[model samples]
Target chain A: MHPVSLRKIAKVYHLDAVTVPALAEVSLDIRPGVFTVLSGPSGSGKTTLLNLIGCIDRPDEGEVIVADQAVQSMSDDALSDFRARHIGFVFQTFNLLPVLTAFENIEYPLVLAKMPAAARKKRVLELLDAVGLAERGDSRPGQLSGGQRQRVAIARALATAPKLVLADEPTANLDSQTGAAIIALMRKLQREHDASFVFSSHDPQVRAEADDVIFIRDGRIAGVEQRTAATQERAAS
Target chain B: MNTWLLALRNLLRNRRRSLATLLAMVVGLTAILLFGGYRSNILYGMETGFVQQSGHLQVQRRGYFLDGSDNPSAYGMPRYREIIDAIQRDPVLAPMAVVVTPTLQLGGIAGNYSAGASRSVVASGLVANERNHMLQWNDYDMISYAQPLALEGAAEDAVVVGTGVARKLQLCAALEVANCRQTPAADAPVEAAATGSPAPDDVLALSALEKAQQPRGAYNRIEMLAATASGAPNVASLTVVKASNFGIKAIDDIYLAMHLAQAQKLIYGAGRPEATAVIMQLRHTAQMPEARARLTALLASDFAGEPLEVLDFQTLNPMYRQTDEFMASMFGFIALLIGVIVLFTIGNTMGTAVMERTVEIGTLRAMGVRRGGIRRLFMCEALLLGAIGSVVGLTVALMVSWFINHSGWAWTPPGYSYAYLILVRVWQDVPLLVGSVLGMIAVTVASAWWPASRAAKLQIVDALRHA
Candidate 1:
């Protein structure tokens, strides 16, 4: 089954008396265990779609099903549990709690899951090594470089082995070299953890590394293109 | 790491704001504790004073507390000595009774016959050694001691009059009294007697022969006049041994203390000697209720048909209760003021912290922490501040109280004519210390509730976008 599927989902925002339709009747399916990109320019509903798939926001109409469960039907606590177990997210700013170290930030989701300390520590250490931040585990977010913070964020998203990881503008604030490194690290982690990575980006280089690219404009999906086996293999490599 | 550790770290992120909030809490808490201790001392000091003077409980005739001062002999307990003995020997009260004795109250006119001046006075006749023992009751560790009466082995006719009486009698010089002021009218009688001039009726009525018998200003001798039990006038010649200050203006103006035998003779000559009150000083002030209960039971059964009623020191002296209530009200008002200050201080700090951490809160929520967890995190931080402030505040309060106790500062309280130690009592009072701590914590948590709730109810996506 697809990790996430949306059917004619819509979202709106009200600023004072003005109503802005951020997303309208968007339909998509995210293939399991693939690196996908929702490619669009600013205010193009790409991040809105990522938020809907992450179960962080609700749609005004239609259905959003994640891990084969309709997310909109769950209570807030149940939805939180669902998100903690089945989904993870990465922000453009790498929103790690500033007070916690990189290791503690990666262990946060597992702590939410109430994993025992021994198991949480082992899992956090393994994820830190996987993200090339094992030795920098004790460094706070303020002490880490942009590329290093993004690597730590990727490890945190995959810490619970979630079925889907949604990122919004994952490289918008990074230098080109750091951006390319983060993109490569995310792709490698997706392959290693076998979790679907659906991130929103406007960068052509970023979209070029995706197994699937969905283009959207004006709150509606414009197109979806799936790479061939050779192209997917090359992208994965 | 644990949630508390996370909360502590979050607080440490903004050290200045957190310290400001903590300082507000600590200052408020210390002020509250210090005032609370001072209030305790006032009540304790007054309690010790009353117990030392009038014993913890007194057994008096019915209607005595209301009207006996007007004519105390009418309500006199004729067999008070036997009653005191029974109380001292009773199985239940024997251990608690530190001193059980009888006191005689009489109203009379004290006249310096040689000076040709007379003023109305109220006198207490006390067993000198027993009265000295009663003056030594210091149950709350007041660190104060009363000077024993100087009439312990003096003649039965010796007496002590207040400085006010000495001033009115124009005998301040003879008694070696200090701070005594004599009115010009006080010399009118003596001056008239010396010049053979006309004088007021009180001075003119005294026989010239009596005034001539004693030299003017040569001796501290006074004549006491009181109506005997049969309503016949009786007079006694007393040698004034001392003029003491009773620390109350009105009581001092009319105060006299003499040996019991002399007072009984002056009031009930050739008849059964009686006592106005059976003073029972207890080993501890806390034992008053038990001692009173047992004494009342004894009076009802063993000394029936005497119209006797038992009264505790607090009940007998309503001023103590009034002062206590007044102090309590003032303390409550000050405590409320400080509590409000602390409340708003902590609230503002938490409010600012919530605003600064909006995106962090959203991240926590996205990482699967429930709203309750968010609320608890902030509340934990606030409570930690309160707990630390209380402990440190109490420590500071105790230190300050100890310093003041040893500072030798003294000030007269209301209704007192002399100054007393400015003492603050706190260490042995567990209820005050524990209640202050809990009250501070409760205020801290309550203050944080609104901010914590706001943090919890934040829209995740909106918070993530906060700048």
Candidate 2:
């Protein structure tokens, strides 16, 4: 079964007196345990589609099925619980709580999930090591470099071990070298953890690394491309 | 997860703003407490003064309080001694009544024979020891208003006159009254000289002609003249012992005190002696209702068929109630104003915090924090602010009270002749202290509700894009 499925989902935003269509007629299925990329330029409804799939924003029309539950049929509080358990989010700005340390930031979602403190501490430490920031756990976001802060954000997103991890232009703010390293790290973690990883990015490095690439334009999917095993091996090369 | 710790960390994020908000609450609470303390001090002081001077309760004839001064002899309690005995032996009043005594009131003319001057005077006759005991009543443990009468142990002819009376009768120098200024127009036998009327104050001349008599001496002595029960003129020679001020000029000008015999001899000569009022001092002011009720019952059952009434200190002195109400209103007004200022101060601080943390709120909401959870965090911050502010405010208030009490500050009341030490009483007043502290903290917490609600209702998508 697909980890995230959007069937004819539409989202409209009202900015004062103007109503703009952010996404329309978007139907897609994200296969589990694979790296997928939603490649689109700015204002192409990439972030809007990610928001709907993560259950943070509701679609104006159609069904958003994430983790086998139609999100539109749930109450706000129930949707929050569902998100805490089944989906994680990564923002382009690396939105870490400034008042908390790196370890606490990763542990925040587990706390929201009401995980036992001992288990939370264990999971947070493991994720800290996986993100290559085991020594930086005690440092706040203000004290970390841009690359290290993004790594902490990724660790926090994966702390609850959700079935789906959604990233909105995850590498938009980093340099070419840091963005490549982050993409490689995400790819390695997805292969090992076996969770569906969906990123909204137009970067060539991110597009080259994905097992499936969906092209979107003007809130519509223009095409979908799935690589074979040999094609994926060539892309890896 | 420890939400309180998160709230504390958020509070510590902007230290200066939090400090400013806390300072507003602290100052507001401190001002309210100090004002309340001052009001308590004033009312307590007034109560102590009245209780010391006249006792907590007085039993008098039915019309005595209103018209007793018109004819003190007519309203005299003839069976006062028996009534005093009954009250002193009563079951309820026996434990509460510290000093139950009888006093005689008379309106008469006092002639200072040696000075050759006389004036109309209002006099009270009492047992010097009993009056002296009544002078020491201070139930609130406040500054003492006790001043023992010098008439204690003195001869029956001895008397105590107010400083105004001394000046009125031209006895200031003789009484050794410092700063005594005499207006000559009110003194001397000037009325007779100007109008050619028989000098009404010529007690010696009148004594010889109208069969009036004085004691055979030319010392510091006065002859009290009053019409007896039969309307016959009578006189008793009194020796002046001490002159004391009664604080109010009107009462001081005509006030005098003498032994009961001297007063009875002058007013009820050759007749049954009586007292105009019986004074009963109690252990505390709070026991007034029970004392008044018990005394009323005793007056009705034991001393039935007699026209008498029970009057508490507050009733006898309406000035205490007026002053109490006036100061209370002033205190409440000031407290409300300060509370409003504190309310808005805290609300503004929290509102600014919500504005600054829009993105953080969006991030938190996205991480599965419900709206109620967002509201709870801000409320926790307000509770912390209130708690800290109340404690520090109480400490500051107590320190201020202590400083003022030990500083020897004194001010004369509106109609008083002398200044008293200014004091602040709060700690012993449990209701005022606790109420003020709780009210302060409650206001602090209440002030944050609007901001917390607003923060909780923000749209997560919009908040995330605010930056």
Candidate 3:
């Protein structure tokens, strides 16, 4: 089964008395173990579509299936449990809890899963090493650079060994060098963990490295592009 | 991070605001405990005084309180000796009673011939040695109220008049000086002629006007006169040995204490022994109910089918009962007021903290923290705050109480003529400590509920966008 299957999903938001359509007839199949990027200009409903797939919100009219379970049929608690067990999320702002150290932030998802402390500790150390911040495990989010914070958030998102990692503008706040490094780290971790990654971005560099780039415009899927391995390598260089 | 650990770290984020909130809690708690301690002290003092003044239990004829006012000797407890013996024989009662003494109350007139002053007085005849020693342990002024018993010195006819009675009669150190009645200093020792003929030197020093006041050189002669139980006139021309200040305005105005036998003979008749009541003192005031129950049972079994009533201090002194109730109500109101202020302070603090952390809350929710987990985190924070504040407040309260107790401050309650030292009993007060601590914690948790729930209910999508 595909990691995510969206069939004609639509969402509408009401601001005061004004009705605005954020997504309409958005259909997609995100296969496992692929680095997928949803690319569009501002207000192209890229984040909205990502939110629907992550189960943070529901669509106004459509079927949302994540990891072979239809989320609309699940209760709130069941949906949260499903998300805790199978899905991970990364926000545009990094959203790292300020009070937690890098290690603790990374271990948070495992803690929510009620994992054993020894295993949690082991997994958190591994993730810290994977993110190239093993020496800075004790540093809080505030003490880290933007690239370092994003790395911590990325490690946290993969802590539960989720089937899919959904990221919204993960490199939005970093400089060009830091953002490029973050993207390389995410791609490398995606390959190492064999997890499908679906991230939204307007950056051309991100679209170039994507195995599949879905372009959305006016709340609809405007086009799709498939990149060859050689093209991806050429774009990365 | 664990939830509780995260809560603690969050609390430390705004240290100044948290500290201010903590201080409010500490001050509120300390005020409640100290005020409660003060009231407890007052209650303790009043109870000890009342019980010591009129023993833990008093056994009197059934009608004594109601009808004995007109003819007190007529309602005297005829079987008082039997009741005392029974009290000693009972296994449950014998250990409870420390002192059991019979007293005779007589109403009469007292005259100071040297000062040409006379007044009506209420007299009590007590077993002198026991009565005098009992007063030594009393919480009232030992100097003013109990010192006069020493002057009697086995003189059966001598009397100790109340200070109010003495002031009214103008009986002074001697009649040698004029203006002895011009508002005599109330604290002067009762120095007068012996309970016999005066010394020649003392008589010689008397002014001519004093001489005219008392003929036959019996210048210090004070006469006590009362009617026998049969309504026949009886008189005892005795000398005033000393006077006492009983410390109660109503009692001080008309009190006269004499040897028990003399009072009995004067109020009833020669060779006739009678007592108005029997008073029982106990080792501890808390043993009142048990002791009273045992004594009353014994009294019934000994004098079965007799008209008698045994009463505790609370029943005897209804005014003290009312005063205790009033104090309890007043303190309750104070505790509630303090509790509400602390609750609102904590509630407002938690509310503001939750409002400021909307985005953080959203992040937590998105990370699979359940609503229940969010609520638990806030509740845990409140509980920790209460626990810390209670410790500090209780510590300060105890320290302040110790300081005041040892500071030697004295206060005289209204209607009491003598001053007593201020004291606080904290260690002995388990109920106050437990109740205050629990009450504080309960109020703190209760106050955090609304704010925590509000935070937990915030929609993740909206909270993420909060600035």
Q: Can you give the DockQ of every candidate in the order shown?
A: 0.73, 0.63, 0.61
Note the B-chain TM-score for every model: 0.90, 0.88, 0.84
What TM-score does each of the candidates earn? Answer: 0.91, 0.88, 0.86
**Candidate 2 local Cα displacement, residue B454, angstroms:** 0.8
The TM-score leader among the candidates is 1
Clashing pairs in 3: none
- For candidate 2 chain A, which ten residues in a row score worst on lDDT? A228-237
Each candidate's chain A: what TM-score? 0.96, 0.96, 0.97
Residue lDDT tens for model 1, A37-76? 9988899999888888988889999899999999999988
Q: What tens digits encode model 2's per-residue C-alpha lDDT throughout B243-343? A: 88777767778989998877888778768998888999999888989999999999999889889988888888999999999998999899999999999
Clashes of each: 0, 0, 0
Question: What lDDT is reached at residue B63 by model 3?
Answer: 77
For every candidate, C-alpha RMSD to the true structure in Å: 3.3, 3.6, 5.8
True contacts kept of 2: 0.51
Question: Which of 1 and 3 is the better model by DockQ?
Answer: 1
Best by lDDT: 1
**Could you give candidate 3's per-residue lDDT for residues B184-238 as a string of tens digits?**
3322222342332333342233333333454574544566767788886566766
What's the distance in Å from true for residue B255, model 3? 2.9
